[model samples]
Every structure is written in structure tokens, then in C-alpha cells.
Target: MFRMIPPGLAEAARLTRQGRLKEATALLQGSLAGTRPKPTPARPATRGRIFEVDPATGDATPPGRAGFFSRAQGRPRPAPPLAMPEGARFLRGGFGAAQGERAWRLYIPASLPAGPVPLLVMLHGCTQTPEDFAAGTRMNALAEAEPRLVLYPEQSGTANAQRCWNWFQPGDQRRDQGEPALIAGMVRQVMRDHAVDPRRVHVAGLSAGGAAAAIMGESYPELFAAVGVHSGLACGAAQNLPSALAAMRQGGGTSTVLATARPTIVFHADQDRTVHPVNGDQVMARAGAAGLRAEVERGQVPGGHAFTRTRHSDTAGRVMLEQWLVHGGGHAWSGGDAAGSYTDPLGPDASRAMLDFFRRHG
Candidate 1:
């Protein structure tokens, strides 16, 4: 018999290669409604399972069902409201734009430093709220102690049933558009409302939030002095659901959007399951700084896990990229509190380390 293949799959591949990811996704969704046509590839198609939860990218559907946010795997579900600390206020507000709007929580310390203080933007992972993320990361406490501004931009359940940042969407991955634009708007609003040092603004996130942080840093390198990604993928890791799944399971394709390099620090557990650790490697490579030299160091937290830290410096001798591989760590934030969710207290204090890194870079 003559070799035959699924015509739609070939067309979808072409569409993907052309960077028409939504068209490709729609084609596959429509094609899968029918039986799989016999394949004619000389190389047999690999048999494996793609994650079902990814389509939550659109239609807000969760895995094994036609809706979003049934639950997140392997984490206690708690969306606790943040507690106010002495002499500090956690205020809520929203930033609106033509494309969309994002509600955010700002942490104002009891007393501000004499000069305009740095602004740190924190994006929470999927299924997490600003309050839950603030509690889990203990970021607000740190901001109060150091007396800086901390902003937490929220992802709406209406946009993502799991309340994810939608990092995989092609539109959301670019500058001056989509989710990045909305987040940047919130940051600017905070800057205008407070005494924020323009050059000292920074951004970071955990997991899905981390991935979104990468996009923000890449999209607005001049805006964010440094970038921190905890257990996250690089910018342009995926354009849609299928590509996002592949990028999460493995390292992603070459960066689709990159320009001047910014100071970046990344953290990923060696044993992370939800997002493969190899993705951290990709984030470092995405820096694309010149004549980079990498130095490795290993250290163990007093009562916590051991980690390997690699610093990549350009010829100018400025360490521009740092990667921390937490041994035996999982998908949770390293050295995080358990009060909220998806936190492991046994790793290095990622929040403090990120702040330190931001200080040096900014």
C-alpha cells in the first residue's frame, strides 16, 4: 500500500514552522476530532502522552475535563489573604489599559529610605493569588525590613482558570503587547504613585510566574534592571499549548525574542518534575552576553539542602548571569515558608538571594 499520513498534522507542522501557532493549534484541535489517518513517515511517530492541562492556555479548561482550575497537582490549595505587618500597609489596586487590566498588591514599608527606593515586581505561579504568593515567599517581610516597594501583579481566574500568567501565549510573549504590556503598566503606575528609582526596578517570579518574569525582562530590559527566575522557562519557550508542553518537559527551542542582555539570576531544583531543570540552562544561554566565562561553586545551607551556583561573567568582569541548582529540590520555591502553598523550607532562601542579586545588578 502507498504510504499515507495525516494531512492536517503536516499542515499544522508547517503552520508552526511559520510561527502561526494559534492557527496550528486550531488546526490540530479540529483535526483531532476525526480518526488519526495512518502515518507514512519513514521514522515512526513517537508514542507518548502530552500533558492535558496545557490547553488551559485557552478556553480555561483543566485536564481531563472542559474547564479550568479543578486543582493543581501535588500542592495544597490555599488562597490565603496576606496579613499586614507592624508599621506597613499592603494596598490593593488595578492598572487598566486598552488590551487588558491587572489587579496588583503593593507593599509599602513603615518608612522609606532617604532616596527613591528600588521597586521589585513579583509574579506568582499558577493557582496562586498575590496574598498567597506574598505569604509563601515572605517577600513583604523582606521589603519592610529593607524598606523598599514590592509589587505583586495578579492573574485573573477569568483569564486563566488556574490563574496562571499565560506565559505560553505568543501574544503575551512580546513587548508592548498582551500580558507584558499590562504588567509593565502596573509597574509604571507604582513608579508614578511612589518614590521609585527608575534604574533600580527589578522583576522575579516562581514557575509560571517565573516564565512570565522572563518575558517581562526580555520585553522590557531597560525597565527591569535584573531578572530572577525560580523554576521557570526562558522567553519564547513556547507559542501555544503543544509547544509549551514540550518546552516544559524538555528545554525549549531557540529564543524567539532577544536583544540586549540584562542581569539575570535563575534557580531550579535538580529534581524538579513539573518543569525540567534543563530549562534553567536555557535561561542562562538566552542572556546572549559576550565572551561569557562560567565559574562554579558549591555550598550547603546550614540546615538545608546543598546547591551548585554558577556565575557567568562577560569580558568586562561583570557577572551577568547566575544559576542555582538546588540538589534534591522539587518544584516548590527554595527556602520558602509553608504558610501559603508550593513552598519548601529546606532550600536556600531564594527571596533573599534574589534581592541580593537585584541590589548588585541594579
Candidate 2:
């Protein structure tokens, strides 16, 4: 029998088979930094059932389909528009660049403490806008409550038809390059304009955005003190679309070496068909591969969802990784507002959990 493997994955698998765990991990993780290949019109071959719904009738298209959207089985219910949070100034702006321009939305608290406050950079998932993500995550409420500054960098449709962060693309996965540079630049801009504590800046995202957040932590550990990845893959999980599709269908190939890794917290639903639950495990595996101790616990969210949480700590017992797997949950934000899209109101509040975890690290 003959089978073809993606170059990056094949190399990683080979290293793992030879028992060179450390080298294998580094190769898999660093694969994201590989150069971008020339654009080809051919779509990546996909395995597994397509998760989508016919928008016109709101019915599940039979077994195999062309598009992707892990929408609720039927026509999706209309989500209400997100209301602006009180005591926060919702401002829109643009970031200039050599590559192109990007639109950004910032939420600044009306009142500030005597000293510099924390900053949280949030990246939205596919088919979502800043307004929609803000509404769905209800992150604005948390920002106002914490008196923190928040930045939402939107992915233009020009970059991707689904408005997804190019996490699978090599150029977009490294520090000071492609999308990562743009996002880091946005953080710098916010820091300059506000009383943001440089040491307290953190980044978090959902799905593709989550994967990008992981890359941010990997590439700019100096800039970001902590990271939150919700239903996302580990950094360097895939280098291109085909590899990405394969990674999503099964799991990412192997692991790689990283210069540094910031404290990370992950949230995922065990039943997440869109990205797969094992990716959550990979996120933790990659984080702990550098000799961190891991402790696992299982519990259920009150009247909401059941979950397994794994905490990784350093030799000194400082927590480095917090991975949460929501049992019986789907591909949506846990404990999110119904006002936004792709949210599950029943799980433990990821927004709060991440905030608490981030504060400790910052």
C-alpha cells in the first residue's frame, strides 16, 4: 500500500518513531515557520463529514458537502445585535502597513485607575466581525468590569473569504511577519495611546483565531505575557491549507522546539466537530513538552456542561498551562451570550476563566 504524507508531518512522524521526542516536537512546532508555497487553485482534499447547513432552507445538507460551517443542525436562529457596554468607549480605527491596511475596533474603559491597566487583544473566528464577537463573547463587559483596555483586530474578507486568520499559512504564523506583525503592531499602537501596562498585555481567540493566538504567544513571548486559545490548534499545527485540512481531520503531525512559551489557557468542546477535540490535547502537549509538570482534573459546569481540566505547572508549582475540555459541548463559545454567533450558553464561562488565568500571569 502506498500513502502520501505531508512533508512536515512526515518528518515529524519519522522523528517521533525513532524516539527523538524533543527533536520531533520542535520540528512539528517550528513547521509553521516554513515558507509559504506558491498559490495553487486546487483545493485541499478533505476527509470526514462536512459540517454545514444549507442557508436557504436551514437544513443539514446530506453526508458530504462543499462548504464549512458547524452551524446548529437547522437554519440558525437570528442572533440579536450586541449592545455597546456601558462606561466603555467603542472606537474604530485603521492600521497602516506595507502589505495593506486593516480595520480595528478598540474598547476603552471610561474610567481608569491611577496606574496603567491591563490590555487584552481578542481575535474573532471565521464569519465573525468585531461587533459580533464582542457581543457573543461579552468580553466588553469583562473589560469594563476590570477597567482593562481591549483590542479586536478584524480579518478582512480580502485576506480570506471566510474572514479567518491565516493560521495555516507560513508567512502569517511567525513574529513580525504577515498577520502576526500586523496584530503585534496593533498592540503597540494601543499601548502608546493608552495607559496599558506593557507586561500585562495578553492575546486570545476562537478557532482559527485561537490558533493564531497560540502563534502570537510562541512568536512574541516577550510582548505577550499570557495567551488564551479557545477551540484552537497548537502553533505549527499545519503549514498550508491541505496540511491544515489533514490536521483538522485527524490531528497535527508532531511537535517542535519553541524559543519560549507564555502561560497558556485553552478551551474546547469534546464534541467540537469543526476543529476536533484532540487539538486541545495537542495544545497542552506542545506547551508542556519543555519539561513542565501536568495535573489533570475532571468536573462538570453547574447546570451547564461537564469538563476535564488539565493544569501544567513549572518546577516551582507555578501554573503554566490550563486546558479545559467541555464534555458534550459543541463548536461554540462556552457560556457566551446568545446575542452573538456560534456560542453555547451552557458551559463554564471561558471568558471569566481566561481572565482569571491571565491576571495571575500578568
The lDDT leader among the candidates is 1
lDDT of each structure? 0.77, 0.75
Lowest summed lDDT window (length 10), candidate 2: 48-57
Lowest-sum lDDT 10-residue window in model 1: 43-52
- Tens-place lDDT per residue, model 2, 112-223, is 5767999999998865678878888999888867878889999876676556788988999988789998998888898888788998999999988999999999888889
> Which lDDT tens digits does candidate 1 get at residues 1-362?
54343356666555444434345556655665664433223322222211222222321233123222322333234456666667788889999998698899999987667779999999988757788888889998898777789999998766664677889888898998989999999999999988899999999999899999999998897899999999999998887665675577677886543455568999999988778899998888787644578899999998889999988887888888888999988887899987766677899999999998898887
For residue 315, what is the lDDT in candidate 2?
A: 82
RMSD values for the candidates in order, in angstroms, are: 7.9, 9.4
